[model samples]
Target: MKDVARVIVTYDCPRNCPNCCNEHIGDVPAVKFEDLLKYKELVITGGEPMEIAPRVVEMIHRLQANGYNGKLWLYTSCLKTTKWADRAVLQAVNGITYTLHHKPSQKDLSDVCKLNKYLLENLDNRAHDRSDRLLIDSRCYTEEVLRIIGLYDTGTKHWSSIKPLEWKDDECPIPDNEELIYYDLERV
Candidate 1:
């Protein structure tokens, strides 16, 4: 697979999710148009890309205008409001890999489900052709982070990294019944 240039646009996100890597809320710098033009795959991510949906849409439009034909992906926590997820934003993005945190509350699950439904309903039918483009990255293992490299569903062509708050080598083991699958996104 050809290597694609990727960038994490901002650290600022809307949710105060427990497992968030960015601990504090702050301003997320707008990705320079030139920088967006240089990459084959541009991943617009942040505390919540939806917070800056207007700017994100502008960035995507600019990229397309610049002849960037490569896939576009969004790494989102999906905690933002649905109004921000208008068709224009969905049209600009190729796929979304929603990060599902471990032991999330029922409210959180409901929120995610709602967001997913909105994405599925509002986007064009051709968006389904890009269903391989959407994914749910459920953070499964706190131990055996390496094993995570294999937990993906090959059919979906999506995977997520799991990081435990407390990890000790050889302390936790994966269950025997568990099956491992590898996904190749480039193929999708």
Candidate 2:
């Protein structure tokens, strides 16, 4: 497993990606800065972290203040970074990963791309004294599971059929006689 802790701070996102495990995440406690100490990298995710920009900034500041010098990675939709305050928060983080999902309109993509361009330019200028860790979707992984099984091609559809897992009948909830099969789509 990767030596990274994915701390999800909120279950409230504007776009409900079909593959998201947000329902299972529930209302977990907000992350304290100390929670990041055990890992080399800390990924602050959410329904969308930008949903609570001020709180995110506080988390970053707290981690920095406590002398936790690990790399901080932010996973966001790039929707809220359009605001100056949110951009400032992004400027503080070491790296960012933008989530690419179903965009209903070209305008949405345009706005996100605009912010992406700005972050690429501003967050990587050594002459301007910013960190050199600005990133797009550069995940170091052997495999990726595109869980678009429940995804819609467009619009506000959600994963209504797949509810959060529930324990029942004194056993885990796999079908009694079903054999689970996994397929390897590609090899890295």
Candidates in order, TM-scores: namely 0.55, 0.58
What's the residue-level lDDT of 165 in candidate 1?
A: 38
Error of 2 at 160 (Å): 35
Evaluate model 1: give its TM-score: 0.55
**Top lDDT: which candidate number?**
2
What is the C-alpha lDDT profile of model 1 across 1-188, one tens digit per residue? 22343444444565565545443323323334564555566565555666566666766776788898888767665544355544466656666656655555556556655554454456433445443232333353333322232232121222222223342323433234321111112121
Candidate topping TM-score = 2
**Clash totals, every prediction:** 2, 0
In candidate 1, list every pair of residues with a backbone clash: 12-47, 13-47
Compared with the true structure, what per-residue lDDT tens digits does model 2 show for residues 1-188?
23666666665787765556555433444433444565666667666878777777776776788887877766676455568657767778675665444433455455544554564455544334333221222221111211221112221121111122222223322233322121111110
Model 2 shows how many backbone clashes? 0
